[model samples]
Target chain A: MDIRKQFGANVRKHRQATGLSQEQFALQHDIDRTYVSGIERGKRNPTIVIVNKFAKALDVSIADLFDGCD
Target chain B: MDIRKQFGANVRKHRQATGLSQEQFALQHDIDRTYVSGIERGKRNPTIVIVNKFAKALDVSIADLFDGCD
Candidate 1:
């Protein structure tokens, strides 16, 4: 899969694992809901800062988000 | 260190391992030399696409770029 898609999938997986809907996740993380949606749909290309935010919110390493993406 | 700085250090490490100067590596990878320099200095916040490009150029996984970053 494309890295963006893979990242989106990973984000979705981790978010779901936390039992938070996209909106809830965004609210809790201080990220825009629409932006989160875009990211989850692979329609957005977030910078490393934003990626780090997601990793922090998800309690995962940056590497974990790209796991199995190769 | 910050993730961006760590990423820059990792990029520099990999690029040096390949025995290529920033200009030479940029020319070979079709990336802007100044952009590479910016990335290496952690002054640029690259999106995942650019990160993927670096990973591909370095023949490493996205995870590798982030190794020891956390």
Candidate 2:
């Protein structure tokens, strides 16, 4: 189901929904901005803990990231 | 939120719910039983893609892995 793309799109959606830039998202999460870019592009494979971090930084839930992917 | 523990516990729950042993679960997902053990113990970190794989193999949604872990 291209979960990477689905997850990435959901992450991007959450970021945008919160009105945060990639840089802001990265900063808030203490992750590198480039990594955030990679995640959004579905180029980076992040771990479950990392996904949880993204969810936290975006003020969303791990479940939320799988809105359509699931 | 101790996401690792939360996430790992959820994985164990899903695996148990499906009545699959560690080896069986590992075989279905093509992941190593030891690695699966690590993940289930919250000792290993998995990527989003791997998480998706687990969800698929468990016949559950990614969100289900995060039921009480918002």
**Each model's TM-score?**
0.96, 0.88
lDDT of 1 by residue, A3-38 (tens): 889899889899899999999999998899999999
Pairs of colliding residues, candidate 2: A46-B47, A47-B46, A47-B47, A48-B46
Task: Tell the DockQ for candidate 2.
Answer: 0.78
Interface RMSD of each: 1.0, 1.3
Q: Candidate 2, overall lDDT? A: 0.83
Candidate 1 ranges with C-alpha deviation above 4 Å: none
Judge the docking of candidate 2 as incorrect, acceptable, medium or high.
medium
* Local accuracy of candidate 2 as per-residue lDDT tens digits, A25-60: 788778899988888887888887788778778888
Q: What is the interface RMSD of candidate 2, in Å?
A: 1.3
Judged by DockQ cut-offs, the docking class of candidate 1 is: high
Screening candidate 1 with a backbone cut-off below 3 angstroms (N, C-alpha, C), the clashing residue pairs are none
Question: How many clashes show up in model 2?
Answer: 4
State candidate 1's TM-score.
Answer: 0.96
> TM-score of the candidate numbered 2?
0.88
Q: Write the per-residue lDDT of candidate 2 for residues B1-70, one digit (tens) a residue.
A: 5677777898998899888899998897789999889888888778777888888888888888777776
